[model samples]
Target: MELNQLISVNFNLRKPKSSTPTPLYMVVYYVDDKGMKVQAKIPTGKKVHPSLWDSKRQQPIMINKGIDLTTNQLSEQAEVTAYITNCRILVYSEKNLNFDEIKEKINLKENNEMSPVTQQFISAKKTPKATKAMEVVLNSINESNKSENTKYAYRKNYNKWCEWLRDTKQVDSMKALSQLKFNEFKKWLVASGATNAMVNDTCGYIVRIIKEIVNGEGAIYGVKEVTFKKLATTSTNVKCELLEEEIEALKDTKTISEREEFYKNVFLLQLATGQRISDTYTIIKGEYDVLKDDNGNEFIIIKNKKSTRGAKVKKSYIPMTKEVSDLLQVLQGNELIPTNDKTLTEYVNIEIKEIARRAGLNRITPNGNPLYSEISSHYARHTVTTQLSRKGLTSEQIALQLGNSKEMVERVYKHETDSDIIAKLQPAAANTPAPQVQAPAQPAVAKDKDLEYYNNLSDDDKLLYTKKLNDYNVLKDDFFKSLERQPERKRKAAAEAKTREIVQVWGFEGANDMEYKKLCFFLDLIKQDINDLILTYKVYNDEAPQGGMISAINDYERLLINIGKLTYYCHL
Candidate 1:
């Protein structure tokens, strides 16, 4: 039906119960967006005798004194016309407005008084001037630089909140989203079978959007700051990861069915990329770049769907190791890329568990769940993160490969226990010699052993070491200062090689045999060099530093871990 035919109104006479005049009644009927018919009858409070009523025209006839409408009757006709116009505007403006809401807006409950809309219409103020947080959120999502998936998630969360309000017969307003109701919403999601992580994410998005709407800088909405209790995550620390051997087993297993083969390949692709299932699927579908650096080293770069909106690290740069390159080739050859479907994760999760079981990964986790039972597409990321951290990649390097923040990698991705730490350090401890008692020294000239070691070096060796250190510093400074004059790729590669050479020449074996004072002194020098490079790259070049600069900084940060010092570095 045409939009103009959506609503109709008619004025008719009331039932003739008395001999005197009968009042006029207004009937409003319309078809809502959901194809439901709605109607309401409103009394006009103006009457005409039967003889004076013009049945055909539906108005009082102008048959001299007895038929002509009185002043009050004339006013009633004008008010009814305004009501009809206001009703049309409301119906046209709001596609989701239901009949009950329309009745309230048009004053069906208090028939004698004009509704807020009708009153505003008569006063020529048809539209109200106020911002609704819900509408603001929708508009913001539409306008944001967020990926389509992220935008859809935000919209879904907002729509779910609205649906809950409607189901609970509560008003849809910012004031209605109280702390208690927010908590209840979390419970409701879990009861509805959502995982604890899903519940937390949904709630977190809602809170973030509402907080922006209410308290953001220069936000003119008249909403108060929304404060809710921090929800404690109830998710157990179940080991949702496959062991290295288990992964290899899955890789070598013969698939019993085509579905198992497809999902297994998909899972392996995820492990290679260390991406979310969505991103892994995207990469397989060829929505990625395989570019080679000046050293002819190929790497894959992808715009992370989750971190596309004003994120500091928007792209994941994964070195194209033989494993990753070979897997990509196999996936391409077999046409094993997943379709872009919302149910892809669910399907992959379900199928991969059976695949794992078939491959003999039947170990149980500490949480008492079978390892295959805990296996899912997401575990690929956890497994990769843990494996990379174990292989001595610093948090920053892992974060770059995974497209996550360094802090996030350390706090959430690198999963290690106290025993794991002890196991790693035990070898170095075993190699160190026990301290020996020294003969009594003269009280006036107690020697600093670390300083003494530094002074004992040959004069020529000291000069060469200083010259190499200064040359490395000058190279970094010149590369940054002349960034516009040279090919950045070539300059960066050279700078990186020089950095490695300088570190190698120093022969600094961290934490194994170095004394505490000597370690601190060298650590201070490394820290100073890192600071100088940061200033050169960020302040002077006005561009973020990458590759070797990041490697050096990460090395310094990791060394801090052995020394039990706080790891602090510039965000860049």
Candidate 2:
């Protein structure tokens, strides 16, 4: 009988009592290729029975006597069933049966009939060694002497590797494990579309597992040694910077949105004070002081929260310009902005990049990523230093204001000296030198005819030409005089006006009451004289009543120019 026939067979057996006559009811059937068939019935439940060949006498014979039952009683019974059941019975012919054919048939039948979960259980039972090894590795990872997070990462990587090995490589027995085999597995990992970082991490986990198997309590489990070729580090192409126009454009955006307001204030504060995002978010109200120095020059003091030990500890004391003061006033009421350093930095960087993209300032690198250039929130400090340098502040002076070393200012900032800055800041030389008039030189001794010709010209024509020349000369004189007075009187006048404004705002009662009061009075008097000059120039230029008017206008203009120069000096 074939295995397929045996799959559907059902049978029963019985043995007779000692004294009772056995009832003959059992039946057997067999078939042959020659169309021959046979059937037989023997006394049922009889251990031993005889063939009924003779009528007068009955002969007794063992049930297995005629059959070729070479093996044990169980084998004989199994063979009888195999013969009667019409199924393939390879187990009866185990020696002559093809092992591969039998295995294939068995596997096919099992696959067709078994549930998925049952199949998994059979597979697990078959690979008990590999399963036990995996458990040991997992246990070692759980009891690792590393940080909690590190252990967690290791376990995650290990589980992933184990799953891959089981699913793809069909890795089970200890003898199948090898470094060469693992190298192939690594290639598969790359082909499996894992990222470079992921591949590295997975390989790292495998290596750690091998190490643990070798050195950890799981050393008894056979684990092969692994050597991996290190993967290259991927570059992080991150760009963060604001453009000049973008920074300028931020000033015009005035939405009441909290994010917008936060960004604006943060940006303005950074630009004004040159503070980092980290330090800017933590600035308290009381940390700033708008006060005068010993020389009575007004300055803004900012105590840095991020200062470390062994560094220059001086607070950033910038001069309180109108722009800076206005920004501070706007931010005065809020306790803190709605962001921390990391978020603000990231937000500003993203917005700056977006702004650059919108403004057509987005620069692309050779590799097609955004190029790193232009201004950022952090660049505000450099901008301030550069602007101050442009305003003719010395490196030392800037360093003092920024609370940095002069060497740092010169090296990192590349700050120019006051003289160098002045050279750049000065206006290009004006054309034609204020329209000078050339006086006619005396003519060489002329013949009598030449002299007679000179006398023949009309007096009206000569008078008109002379007046034009004189007027040109007068204008030229006044222009030079204005230039000469610019460094002194005009600047002084402006300074005095600003001083008086400050005093009035502060409501000082009298000039002699305090040093500040005296300074205010002096400044006011100087401002009054400068104002009078300006007024006189306005009056003279408006109505040219007489020749004296030109002289007065020129004088007042000179005084005004002087006051402007004096103001610059006073600020310094």
Candidate 3:
């Protein structure tokens, strides 16, 4: 099955950078091709010290503060492990599990409302041997007919692993990868400041590559089994769908900057089609792709490039609304809001938050973060699926529209809301008995106990609490800022050095004249992105606004291409 059609589950610290104990939250996000988001955070209700969490494992490390784990820490670690296991079952299971059902199972086990699930371990046997890096790469490529995008992601990750292990971990041989200390490898990857998701995906690539080598012809060197638990990057709530009023406001906006207007139009286009980032960019200046039916109706028919390479080729057709049809007419000569996926994603994410905030969609998350905190380009797909679901489209119909299976659509695409549940509580017929109670609301992050107490305090006490909270945030920001120190090098020198490194490692040595220019062209995109960041963040006097630094890093991730997929394999 295509990954985009399924939900993604991860674990993360509730307040990772905060210098306080925070509960772990499980984050689930995925596009429900029918235009609904399966994104949500499931709280584990178990807290751990900020330092003890492990990025690659998404589970806590057994050791703490350079010492063996304490009894309490060990208990929390087990709970985290089980929470992840159960979450995986829910997300990956054949049975469709909704958020409430998943939450109920976990809560029931926790509150002793239901019996605990017996944990099961399924082990795979494998023989790993000495393997040549390039040989394994070739085997991985030839053995599977995955999409270029998927292969690029894996190959790029493999490239990073080769660099880090050879440089930092001091591995003597990539050929003997299984002999290396896997835990140490994970530690170095985490310490390099990768987010939980980044580290997890990269490590996952490492394991897959190594396993493939062993399973192929590389089993001559030694016998070994490879295994890992996927990392969890959790979040509690999402800024789900935009309210109809908010959508209408964007449609009716009169006063806005040109750039904002551009993004707003793109956002509307996204909602109309509900395509993934890569697929949406397939849109270019074209009336050619738009077609007329026998009955004189119009529909968009685009090739779905995001699917697996071996999947039967098919065109996705979206019947055009008058709105979509008109939007396409206006998009004729002008560049789409984002020239590429990188800029497009960044531009949409940043603008939507402001748009939603300005349009009065500022519902606060229970965790005290802005509801808009995690809103991004992908939210558009969720918005579309949600609107369709509410319109009473069947799962099969929604799946066909979105190019996914009905089971997945039904599993991840949600039409229900709190209001829906409330409506069900009303009597449908006079003869029918009304249920005594509605389903209990989904569990929410508890308000901070101390803050709750402070609110109940006298006015003078409340004033003191605000002062203290500000001081805490100030100190925390300072510490996070300290963690972001740049190396001591001039920008020109650094850029030159980076170019040299990229060329040396990423595949430029054998580049013919044409290939060389393509590599140069790619590098220029990064340079432009960096320059744009300088202007956008106004990093004057070498001072980095923490927010800008973070936003820029994420945007850069979108742009960082794996040219290695071409350069490394072209000659071979």
Best by lDDT: 1
Q: How do all models score by TM-score?
A: 0.34, 0.31, 0.33
The digit string of per-residue lDDT tens for model 2 on 221-255 reads 34557788877744653323334444654554333
- The collision pairs in model 1 are none
Candidate with the greatest TM-score versus the true structure: 1
* Candidate 3 root-mean-square deviation in Å: 29.1
Rank order (by TM-score, best first): 1, 3, 2
* Runs off by more than 4 Å, candidate 3: 1-239, 253-255, 336-339, 365-368, 418-572
| Error at 238, model 2, angstroms | 13
Error of 2 at 51 (Å): 93
List model 3 lDDT by residue over 60-137, tens digit each: 777656768754467667767766676677667634555666666655443332344322211223323233543566
Please list the C-alpha lDDT of all candidates, in the order they appear.
0.61, 0.50, 0.57
Preferred candidate (TM-score higher): 1 or 3: 1
